[model samples]
Target: MKMEFDLRMTQEQKLIMTQQMQMSVKILQMTNMEMQSYITKEIEENPILETEKKSKEKKDDIDYKELIKYLDDDFNYSNKNYYVNNEEEVSPFTFISAKKSLKEYLIEQVIDLNLSESLKYLCMYIVEDIDSRGYLYTNKNILAEELNVEISTVEEALKVIHSLDPPGIGGVNLIECLKIQLNKKQITDKEIYLIVENYLQSMADNKYAVIAKELNISIQEAQRYGDIIKTLEPKPSRGFYTGEETNYISPEAHIKKINDEYFVIMNNDEIPKLNINKTYKNIIYNDEDEKTVKYVKDKINSALFLIKSINQRESTIFRILTKLVEVQRDYFDMGEKYLKPLTLKELAEMLQIHESTVSRAIRDKYVYTDKGTIKIKDLFITGIAQNNYDDNVSTLIIKKEIKNIVESEDSKKPYSDQKICDLLKEKNFNISRRTVAKYREELEIKSSSKRKRY
Candidate 1:
């Protein structure tokens, strides 16, 4: 073996991600609210960057106005009579009411109980420990020791807590919560009770036959009662204010149909327009001190690049959405059934950009349409082939068809995946039984055995 140690020179090219380029990609991926926060933080730290206030451009005056109108009727807040008249029927939209917290509601109910004062106080203390999920998560032994009371006394107070309204509140576990709710409803069905008490996990796994055998009932009968169990609320504190705020999705763009053409309209209300601070303008490298000149130069470059990155992000989104509108015209014009199959790679090729660029453009972003607000990524569905045809059908359309078929199916003899696939064949969706099963799983639809009812 000869060891060759000759010095050689070769030319090579590699893609390097610069700081500004990385920032641009991040800006591309950010949702509108996130972008707003980022810009605000940048404004605070970077002196050279200031938000540009446009005078006559007249952009971003509205945000979700149409959405609110579409969702609910225009509520009149100027009605003075709502406060004045107690006899008039109070409409839901008449006013915003200060709702009682769960703690307050439970405490108020406890106060009204004809119990001893000490007992009532103990119950209140236990109520204070009930978690947002309406379950008593604290250990009873520890609580009893802390309160200097016997475990039996704490158990007695918990019994009182269990009797409170919102039937499932104060349960130590899921089983207890469900039992409490069932007791309140006067559900004396022994089988259903047994299902809740013992077979809850089995029921979740859709093992109806196992439950039927254990309860000495027919498999069909088990599922019939299982339907009733499905109606029970798991989260008792749901819809009640649990001190946690729920953030709603706000779309970044709207697609509108004017005449026969569809157009993409940007939601600009929250996105801040940027400009270099006019006070610091032309101050870059024009200062008396060399240090000041260097400082100004660096800051100015950063500010300019930040502005450019944001602009580029917006432009890219606009181009992508514009193309999306053209591509998904059928979905917008007709219904979800007409949705075309498109993928990030296919769309990236169509727009002559990298697949990752398209992914980042739509990541965590939503767009409003005549149908409703939907995730931008929802538009990019993989195609399913039709029987002996060049055109491919969207998996979305196929999924919808599958859901409809399942919904209309005879519960006693539910369609198997093979049967479902055969049914779809009549509609020209040339998918296999395995593909049907995959789609069924994705839709969260139960299998033939699980779906069967008495």
Candidate 2:
């Protein structure tokens, strides 16, 4: 046996994701708002990058004939009557009432409180730390350490926060929050407070008899106490706006039906158009210093690459949406009942792109259709085969059917999972009792026993 080192050469192909490629992938996966922010940041950093400006004069110029021609050829605008006057066009910037956020509301209340600067700052810190659910889950000791203050001082600030507007805003947990609200209401009943503090779980489970026996009260009295507890707001910030504001989704593309033919319209209105800055371009072109020219050249290249990547992202999204519309034509024409089962892998194979690419393209993207504005990901659903095996039906459709059946069932004798399965089978859905139960659970529907009314 000879122990010898052997050297061999082998040829293999592999993909190495470059920095530019990674950036492109990131840009592809970004939502519209994220992409806008990213682009704005890029423009701020790189002087060579600028957003293309459309002047009001340029926009209002009388060129209806050319516009109509372009729309017909590029956008497939068939109906002439569909063309609307500019006056009738709805402005995207319609009136929206701005609501003060929970943090803002708390801060305003804290400011009015006459306290030392240190205490005020600490109170604000505690208020800021309160979560969207209007609860301060952060440990007082940890907060003290982070704020570089005494634990006693932090505790005082927390006490102040608990006393602020929107009762139960600074509680540590659900039970504590309820207790805080009860305290604010000056609830004198010790039994009610004890029930909230100790037997919240029992109350939640509707163990009224247990609560009655434990509290030495009748079941009806327990029920009355339960009703009082129910009146207390679980979520203190329920009506108040949290930090997470409602983001209005702008569709990337639209599937419009024109003259019995569906046309895919890419939405470019919302997305900012990028163009190389003419001033920077000229400076780079005429600069004598090699270093300066090189610096400008690098920035120019980066800006160009970013523009190209954005274009690629838009085109990819458009293609995916077009393919989706084509496959789910029945769904578009009708409703959820006609939606077919689809998978990312199947779509990737059909589009000749990687499954991850398909996922990235559809991530946070939306499409406006004759039906409604729908999330791109919602269009692709795992399906189950029908009894006839003619076509696959989306699990969403199955859920919808299950919901309908449950909705129409006799309340006194609600359908069981097995009965629901049988009913679905009669409707050509090949599903088991377990599958029916799973679907019911997903729909948040209770079991037949729970749903049944005596």
Candidate 3:
């Protein structure tokens, strides 16, 4: 055990708060509208920063108008009478509200259950496993394995869950669902309960006579019980809209068709309009306190950083969108038929951006156009091949074509995916049978096996 003081001098390259990293994370997360608002704030706060150029070319001015339109369209804030009379009717539109997470709902309801913290969390985990149709499709053994808890503990929590509101909401299967319903109704008739338990499928398929015969009950009594089953809400959360949904979709950009020439507008509104605190400035002008001066300086720096972040975000997004629009301009004017094959790598190379950056920019980022709200990211894809044209066409166009063929085909004898692909090839659109099936599946179309006539 030797105790020695060692001195070492090393000079290694280090990344000290690079702009590129900030641009990738902070700037890309914000939309064009957010960037614009930030830029305005920067100008107000920081005396050092200024816009590069103020061109009055009227290029893209959708930010102000589109924000006002989207907000006004979904929400009614201007109507004083409506606000006064129907205040309660306004839905909650926040991040919490939109999540619709069943775990949160269960936790809220059972706050007074007096369970231990671990058990409480376990209950929440179990609740999340319940499907939208209110069935706990995952087995307790499986859930226990997943949560690294004992199966017995899951079983115990499940019993507590069974006692919750919206009976049948936490059932493992239809048998449990009916058992919950029967428990809630306090039915004395075992025959009626048995009919619900065993012959649920037959009951669903209107095999009431079979169910009545098996239960040794009259068809009328069985029919009455079936009617009662119909009244039970399968999804207990269906009508219960959360009061936390942020009922506003601020677009990444806007494509306005002004006299047929489309203009790309970046959304920028609701962001805080910042300015230098004149009162604080006046205080500084006079014999200001050192602490106050330092605080203002820090805030001013922060404001400038925020502004630069927003401006950079807007510039990158605008550049990417410009390239996208230039490439997919034909799709904008000529409709779905003219959509070309495109990919993120191709766009990234063109704009000198990382592929992931392109992905983030388009993630949940919508663009308003004459065709309504279109996802900005949907423009890029692998093209569908065509005859006399070596390059591929858009898969979207092929799917649209497939959809058309399926829609036109006789419902009694639906066209197989192979037939649709053959038809498209004859129409000079060269596509594979597998590709047709792929596109058809993407469109959520059932295969010939599933689409068979009764």
Candidate 4:
């Protein structure tokens, strides 16, 4: 081997992620509330940036929608009354009021029941011991021993606790939870009680034949009663305030049809519309201290870049969504069932950009459509070969079909994965058995063995 060293000129072109490009990418991905918060922080840190005041003048009876640029000098998206038809929507906090928590509600009911002092104190102790899942975390025997009372007395308190609102609030276990709710519903069927007590595991395993042998019923009847059990709530605390905060969705854009034309509409009510401060602009030009002038200029450039990046984000989102309305026209016109096969790569190519650019443009962004407010990325669906006619099927549609098939199949003779594949093929879907199994799993449908009745 020989050691060699030489100075040579090399030439190769490569892509580089610049600061401005990074900001553009970041702004594109932020949700509406996120963008608003980001702009507010930027305004606070940069003296050159200030939020432009919205005009208070009224424009009456406009009653129309149009697609337009967001950052133009004539931007009027802030006129909520004119564009949104006085929808008068407010922030989620506006709807927030003091709510009574589950434990608090339970304690209040126990107090109002006017029970004897001993029973009241016992009920209060049990209510305080209940967890957020509505389960009595402490054992009844343990509580009885602690209170120096009999187990029957604790059970009597438990019966009173279980009789409160939200039917299953004080159940000690899942089985007890189901029984409490079923009791409240007045379902006196012996078959349901047996299934709840002795055949729960068998029911879960779809051993309806074993259940039928024990219950003296047909397989069909077992299946029917099992179906009823599935509807019961396992978590009694559902739909109640549990001290957990909820994250609300605020859509970034509205896709509306105006006179048979689709438009990307945005609102600036919460978003800060930024502009350079005239005082800072004057200081930059006249300040004697070079350091001060330099600082002002740097801040001004930063503010301008931020504003430009935000504008670019709005425009890019508008163009992509406008094109989406064209590419996924069937989806918008029909529903989710017609959402065609599309990928970020394919959409990037169609828009003459990189895949990462499309990915960033849709990241965390929400769009309001006729169907519902949905994440923008959900519009891009993976495509599958639908049939001989070359039609494409969305994986969403495939999952939907799998769910429908499972729901409609005979419970006593459930179809296997292969049988489900054959059924899809009969309906012009060309997926394999494994693919069927995958989609079935995604739909949370169990195997044929587990789905079958006795």
TM-score of 4: 0.68
Worst 10 residues of 3 by lDDT: 79-88
Please rank every candidate by lDDT, starting with the best. 2, 1, 4, 3
TM-scores, one per candidate: 0.76, 0.69, 0.51, 0.68
RMSD of each: 11.0, 8.1, 14.4, 7.6
lDDT of 1 by residue, 161-279 (tens): 98888878988888888888888888888999899988988887778899999899998788877878888777787756667643446576777677988767676566777765554
Between prediction 1 and prediction 2, which has the larger TM-score? 1
Per-residue alpha-carbon lDDT of model 2 for 269-300, expressed as tens digits? 55677766655545555779888877776776
Q: Could you give candidate 3's per-residue lDDT for residues 363-407 as a string of tens digits?
A: 767776667677787888787668998888687877788888988
TM-score of 3: 0.51
Q: Where is the poorest 10-residue window by lDDT in model 4?
A: 62-71
Q: What are the Cα lDDT values of the candidates?
A: 0.78, 0.79, 0.66, 0.78
* Better candidate by lDDT, 1 or 3: 1
lDDT of 1: 0.78
Give candidate 2 misplaced runs (Cα > 4 Å). Answer: 1-9, 54-99, 103-131, 136-173, 179-194, 205-209, 216-233, 244-250, 253-270, 368-372, 408-419, 446-454
Candidate order by TM-score, highest to lowest? 1, 2, 4, 3
Clashing pairs in 2: none
Query: Which of 2 and 4 is ahead in TM-score?
Result: 2
User: Model 4: which residue pairs collide?
Assistant: 208-454, 209-454
